[model samples]
Target: MNKKYLFIFTIVIVIFAAFFLLTKKPQQKNTDILINGKKLQVELMQTEEEKTKGLSDRKNLCSNCGLLFVYNQEGFYSFWMRKMYFDIDILWINKDRVVDITYDAKKPEVDEFESPRTIYQNKVPADKVLEVNAGWVEKNGIKVGETIVFK
Candidate 1:
């Protein structure tokens, strides 16, 4: 009888361990960015796959956490809430250390990820864009016309 009870307990423990391993949350990626005089360590999404998967599953972002999008040239750029689980403030920058636009993008409440039909335009052409947690700009006093230096 003791042997039978021990066998059952071992099986149950094995099952629980398997379940825990399979259900473990994915690890977050990290990257470094510099804005103004401050250095920000943030999660990176450099590839197309990573960009598409940006902040979709995350429930929270640490203070000053953000995603930076690098483009080849200065041009008109747009972003939407597609697959995004959180709101962000988008800062558009030109190559000449000029901040052309700032956008406060709200995350979609619905599950379907769709791009906004009309692009949120920028005042100046942008070569790079930085998307940070919502209100991060206001909280950090990050403003337009301030230059972001990449280190």
Candidate 2:
């Protein structure tokens, strides 16, 4: 009787464990961006709100982390340093190729009344925009006409 009871208890425990494992949520993959053969982790800004809030009010960003803005169509998109705390390097990409690069875009001044926030835009239409820490492009040797791979 003791052996039979122990066997039943083990089977019940295994069933519960299997159920829990089947119902557990899977983790999302961390997106990696490759530019000029250098890999960097990036967060995708797919929604309008996320695109609008790109790095605003953040004190700092990780050296290898960046934000990638996604759009439905290729169009001339403008970016401004509104409420930005630090400088960034902006890359405008069309399809898989970089169309333009804005190096060391400065943060807005404390008083917008004194110094108006400057807007930056690409010369050509772009479907995506990437923002990384200032000097990241130079350090990684990223340039226009280079391919960007998302994984």
Best by TM-score: 2
lDDT of 1 by residue, 44-145 (tens): 566778666666667767786777776777888766676567777888878736475465677775645565343455677887777788887777777788
- CA displacement after TM-score superposition, residue 67 of candidate 1 (Å): 0.5
Model 2 lDDT tens row, 42-76 = 88888889898888878999999999999999999
Runs of candidate 1 exceeding 4 Å displacement: 1-30, 96-98, 111-119
Candidate 1 lDDT: 0.72
Candidate 1: deviation at residue 30, Å? Answer: 4.5
Give lDDT per model, in order: 0.72, 0.90
Model 2 residue 40 CA deviation in Å: 0.8
TM per candidate: 0.66, 0.78
